[model samples]
Structure formats: structure tokens, C-alpha cells
Target: MAKEIERKFLVSGQRWRTFADEGIAIRQAYIVAQDDRSLRVRIYGNGQARITLKVGHTALVRDEYEFEIDRDEAEDMLRHAIGNVIRKVRYKVPHEGHIWEVDVYEGVHRGLVIAEVELASIHDEPELPNWVGREVTGESQYSNQSMALGISEGARLHQLA
Candidate 1:
């Protein structure tokens, strides 16, 4: 099992785009989404796909298991997904010594841009880029699972930001 530890922040300006790579198109959905556990299927670009299972109650850390799956199967899973299928383009921006993944949401949750950096340990502090706005690390309302389930709520939060 892999421990997924990361911090999430809202993107502020367009400056980070300078350091970011050409983004990959991503479409993901949850087969099972709950407060402490979830099963998700994600398809990246037009070639790769994965199924992930995450279990934990803590906001910053989770036990995660991911496996490559057939793209056809992943698409079938998305058809049966419990909530909205999330559409986003993910860009990897290198800042300081860490790579921050910036997710620009599309479809129902348009105009939402969130940046996340994975940590090797809980104590590892990644420098925040100037383009990052408010930190939404532990906010459940900003979580992708929550956003998928509550489409209108996600749009409202983006407007408030």
C-alpha cells in the first residue's frame, strides 16, 4: 500500500503556466465515494487508465492502492459511476524542489483550478508558488469526490473563491 500525502491549494494567477508542462487530459469518476473510503477509475489522455482504492479518515494522508486497468473496462466503469464524471487537464509545474500538479477543472466544475503537491512524509514542507492562492488542504468541500457528488456546490465554491 502507498500512503498518499499531499496538500491542496487554489490557483491564483496565470504565472504558474510558464513552468508547467503541456497538460494531460483526464477523466475520472468514483465507483464508490464515502467520507473515509473511495473507489475511483481514471482514464488519462487517450491511452492510459487506472483504478484506485483509497481508505483513510485523515485529510492529509490515505492508504492508496492503484492498478492499471484496460481502457475499455475503465470506460465501462465510468458509465456506471455514482456521480458526475470529472473532466480536467492536469499540468505538472516544477517549483522549488517539488512538482505541483495543477488541475484545471472542466465540464460541470469549470473555472476551478487546484494545485496539489505530494509529500514523501508528513513533515516535508513543499514551498508554495506565488501563483497559489488559499490552501484548501483539509477542506472536504474542495475534494474531488465531494465535487463530483455535489456539482452545484463545486460551482458555488469556485465563484466564492
Candidate 2:
């Protein structure tokens, strides 16, 4: 099985933007990953997509999976996503020796930004970006998917996913 493991964190301030090395402009991928509210399919880029299943207490997980999906197809694949946020402020930060993706959300999640680091193993520590604040990798509140649908601890967020 293809599994994506990573961490999540809440954006403290605008310090991340200044530390960002680059940003990318993206559109919807046109696929769905949500079916039973626990599983979802994500499409990204031109033809990039993945299917993810809610593993456990996502809140306590340091690693989370951000699936790519199509804008139109996202409605079915994902249920907890908030609004139509296609563009993400993606930043490349080096951690340990690996690069972390810090996405400063746009549109509804404009005020929300988080840093994520992907590793081959959960034990590997990567080089971090200068703007990288405290690690919220295991907090589900920082999950992009959760933020979209507003299903965190007590976050009464708007759900348009």
C-alpha cells in the first residue's frame, strides 16, 4: 500500500512567508477521494492524485497526508474540506537533510498557514526552514484536510469540502 506520513503545525505569524524559498501556482486535478467520510481520493497538478484513508486519531499524529485532487471532483472525494481553495502558498524548507513543504493557504484558509516535512521513515529528522516555527506535526488541528472542513477539537469552521 502507498502511505504518506508527515507532520502538521499551526502558523504562528508571518515569519514563514519571509523564510519561504519558492511558491507554486496550481489548479484542481479532477478526482475524488472521499467516500465514507473516512477515505478520500485526491488529484493534483495535471494528473497527480492519491487515495487516503483516515488512519487513527489524526490529531495526535505528527505525520499527515495531503492528497492532490481535482477542483470539481473534490466535492465527492473529500467531505470535510472547507471552501474552494485551489491555490496554495507552497514553500520549500529544508529539515534535517530533507525538504519540508510549508503551505500558506489562500482564499478561506488565507489566515492559516502550516509547515510539513515528509520523510521516508518516521524517525528521520530533516533540515528545517528558517521560518519554520514550533512543530505541530502530530496535531490534527493543523491538518489541511481538517482545516478545510473545520472538524478539529472545537474549531467551528465553515465546511465547503
Top lDDT model: 1
- How big is the positional error of residue 41 in model 1, measured in Å on the Cα after superposition? 0.3
TM-score of 2: 0.58
Measured against the true structure, the TM-scores of the candidates, in listed sequence, are: 0.95, 0.58
lDDT of 1: 0.90
Superposed model 2: Cα runs more than 4 Å off: 11-22, 26-37, 41-87, 152-161
| lDDT scores in order | 0.90, 0.52
Candidate 1: clashing pairs of residues: none
TM-score of 1: 0.95
* Top candidate when judged by TM-score against the true structure: 1
lDDT of candidate 1 at residue 64, scale 0 to 100 = 97
Q: Report how far residue 66 has shifted in candidate 2, in Å.
A: 9.9
Instruction: Give candidate 2's error at residue 20 in angstroms.
Output: 4.8
List, residue by residue over 1-161, the lDDT tens digit for candidate 2: 44456765555555655546767644322223232234445545445555555545534332234555556565454444433334565777654577667776666555556667766776766665555556776555555555444455332242211
